[model samples]
Target: MTALSELNDDVVRSMSIGAVFSDFDGKINCLDFHRTADLLVTSSDDDSVRFYDIATARLVKTTYHKKHGADRICFTHHPSSIICSSKHNPDSNGEFLRYLSMYDNRCLRYFKGHKERVVSLCMSPVNDGFMSGSLDHTVRMWDLRVNACQGIMHLQGRPTVAYDQQGLVFAASMEGGVIKLFDSRSYDKGPFDTFLVGGDTAEICDIKFSNDGKSMLLTTTNNTVYLLDAYHGEKKCGFSMDTSPTATIEATFTPDGQYVLSGSGDGNLHAWNISDEPNKVGSWDSYIGVVSCLRWAPRRVMFAAAAASVLTFWIPNDAKSEPGAPNPEG
Candidate 1:
């Protein structure tokens, strides 16, 4: 059955390439391109971050955004605002607040109380609340609504978080090799419950909620992907790719939940079809350096991935193929 499907399906019919863009003197450590505004933000290992107009593919500005180095960045749902973060270091007392920026890093807001490097940051998919996870083994909620620390939810191990469409939280941790789920409303008390994935496979690297909040996708250092029930974090399905694993650093689910996309230390971008049972329909490869980040842009019909100093846009094969096959970034 697997062999027959492989012959019949155009999982990766072809790849549509966009204008490749790059900047900065060092590796592009993190990237987030805005969908509506057509703005692209990239942070580098050189303690600098740059903004670019994607439609025009022109540099807008450069700012001393990070003191040591930037690890991740994202544009807030707010039109002109962006949020940036770094690993918490004890030597830096006000590092967390220094990381948040507005208007080319001129104005800053501090998020206090996290004692270690911040590992993950995300905006709530439903509400105005934004979240940050730290190596300190805690995930915190910040209400931009009130501009205050709303609550702190402790985790068993350092974890990365993703907010579902309904605003529920899903945290992926290496300690238990599982994803934990929590209601943003009940976060003040503690984690409401957790869904555990067993066996000593490898450290969990990234996690994201499906568009509808009904499913989730997780990646690991072992070059593997797992899909789960988003509400409870239950492992519903999983698949492995042929690409050699680097530090399989990030994974994202397509908006429709039919595909899993990831970037790795091996400098490659991979797409896997999870629309079927017991087997992944197909996979694809691109990019020349370690792909450290991946983000979906539905309005543009493409997804973006960042390597050391480059950004590449990937679109599904423009030609229509069979059903139940990987179409595009979806």
Candidate 2:
């Protein structure tokens, strides 16, 4: 699976279910793969955070938060540490994010400020610095070493944030289809440039930057996913997704950035070949429930999709080891 040749449209088109997990008792809210590890972490409405060894296809650990509940999660460099956003009622208890060491079940710190629950969280590509976007109309930056939020941006609407592959810059998508790019080191100076998302009027649900930093992805509440030229702010293509309001759909770029994939309300996994015109390359419809969360493995030839409580892992069928596969032998 490490071989670069495995990364291709033909291979992705041939991809199918390789593994499935049914351990979750509630809806899975989000999942993330470790940058250089064989691990995948997920946060759910069940108030639990679970870790799966993607290379081994097994659940390694599960921890619960009975007090606050867990929704969004991201690894903080160390495999044992993570940052989790609370799933508690946003109105009653102003939302605060918790940084914890799962190995010992110890709380390390709590990041407080936002008046509403955080909806998006991303770990910086290069360091302990990270970003969180909330329903409170603000995006805040924090460093793992400190307890205070390092920076905050008062946006006009709900926001989503992402860092480029190099982590030298980050992008924020807010109300009115506005996309703002900032220099990571001196973000307070403000965005260097602002781009709009193909004139769409929907609120952006999430934003992602391609590994090469050449493409930007915008997933809006209106079920439209757009791929834009990161530098020039030109729309390269737009795909109308079939997602449900009950689930927050997330679209991802392949590691090579040549394709985009997402799960839909119809329980189908959809992919588009974006090297050019962005045509639908495939739509596998085997899933039984509304596929809500989806993510592409950072380095492996795999992608995972989740429904209410089941998570399905997919891999190219042509590979030596297919279903529930380990890294294929070259």
Model 2 Cα shift for residue 157 (angstroms): 1.2
Q: After superposition, how far is residue 97 of candidate 1 from its true place, in Å?
A: 4.0
Off by over 4 Å in 2: 89-95, 320-330
Overlapping backbone residue pairs in candidate 2 total 1
Candidate 2: what lDDT? 0.84
Which tens-of-lDDT digit does each residue in 135-215 have in candidate 2?
888999999889888999999888989999999999998889999999999999999999987568889888889999999
Give residue 140's lDDT in candidate 2 (0 to 100).
95
> Which candidate leads in TM-score?
2
Task: Give the count of colliding residue pairs in each prediction.
Answer: 8, 1
lDDT tens readout by residue for model 1, 216-289: 77776676677877666668776564345343456776656666666655555666666665344444555456
Q: Report RMSD (Å) for each prediction in the order shown.
A: 6.2, 2.8
Cα TM-score per model: 0.80, 0.94
